[model samples]
Target: FGKNFLITTHYASLPWLDSLLQEAQEKSAEEHLMSRGIAFLLYTFLDTLVDSYFPVLDDIDEIIDDLEDVTVNSTSNDVQVRIFRIKRSLAQMRRVISPQVEVVNALVARTGKFIPAKMNPYFADVHDHLIRAFEVLDSYRDLMGGMLDVYLTTVSNRLNAVMKQLTIIATVFMPITFITGVFGQNFGHLPQVEHDNGYLFWIVLAFMGLITALQLWYFKKRGWL
Candidate 1:
């Protein structure tokens, strides 16, 4: 078997692939990999690539769990950013895994010059691994979507609660504001303003307090509180 094989990527680095290949090269002599021929080496390389996805999927699963809890319990922008980032990661994983599954399925179905009959089962195993990984990725995509929906619902509910409180406060203060404006007018000889011994001040205060209490009671009766 050759000591070197080409691994290409557009903008991503496969450091784990490099490490696995180097390890395989070191053990090639002991495993008699040369005698088994390059086909076995190729199988090993593909198997390593397929197996690498599991650990990454596991990490993503843990992240999804954490995000699920945070999304439900918290209303922070950071949670939203993390959810979108995880969603993007899942999309990228799907893009990479989907084509790989098709390619591996083709390899298993066709025994061409490059793939001998004896190696067909080995390639088929790789195909199975790819299919499993693809399924897991799709599940993660669904979970991420659910997480996003939950986050949005939680945020919306929180906003509605705040708005409800503000509306109640404004509603309760509306009559008091009107009473204040009516009594503050610059008219001469107003009915309440002409009272002796400042009784008008106490009367207006009592009247405003009574109206506020009535409004609060109505709100509570309607379950708006």
Candidate 2:
């Protein structure tokens, strides 16, 4: 008997992957499969599939790791959008692998035809690898959820800081506004109104200074400044 390999995938853009597959195909020795040709061929095929996932998983892990820095440092909304896009890509990969797993299981169950009794273990190994791949994807999904939470928290903190600063500015101006308003009013019979009083200016300056000092102290004490 002879073994023929046919690989069908949606990954048309990766030239290196195509080259790797082509090289493997050309370098594969039929002499190595002289005895258990069918079984080992299936093993080779499934092993390739299983091994391919590790590098992809590694790349995904690296990107996920970088997301923490991106969440903290990036000011552009594109980072969030890129995260969603990566998630969608991961979902697509998961979708593809799930069906492949089902297919492998079905092949394993219908063991009479293409896959013989001797090859069951090899197919089971494929199924195990597929399961591991899915588990990794599950972990990545959880990680994506965590990254989103971190992003939201960082954004909320920045917003709160801005609001706190604005509030402090408004608070500082409040007493100064009160002083200006009192001095601006036309109370003709008031005690300090008759003289061109520098004392009135002194009083206003003192009130403004006292208010500013008090606010600074309160803000410092509250650690909100």
Q: Pick the candidate with the highest TM-score.
A: 1
Question: In model 2, what is the error at residue 129, expressed in angstroms?
Answer: 0.9
How many pairs in model 2 have backbone atoms within 3 A of each other, for residues 3 or more apart or on separate chains, i.e. clashes?
0
Q: Give all candidates' CA lDDT scores.
A: 0.83, 0.78
Model 2 gets an lDDT of 0.78
Q: For candidate 1, lDDT tens digit of each residue in 60-131?
A: 999988878889899999999998899899899889888988887777787655566798899899999998
User: Each candidate: how many clashes?
Assistant: 0, 0
The 10-residue segment with the lowest total lDDT in model 2? 1-10
TM-score of each: 0.88, 0.83
Q: What's the CA error at residue 159 for candidate 1, in Å?
A: 1.0
Off by over 4 Å in 2: 1-39, 73-76, 186-191
lDDT of 2 by residue, 1-225 (tens): 234444456645655456555765566465444345565666666677677888999999998888778888764678788778778978998998989899888767776654678787778889989999999998898888788777778778888989999999999999899878877888767657578556878877897999899999999998987
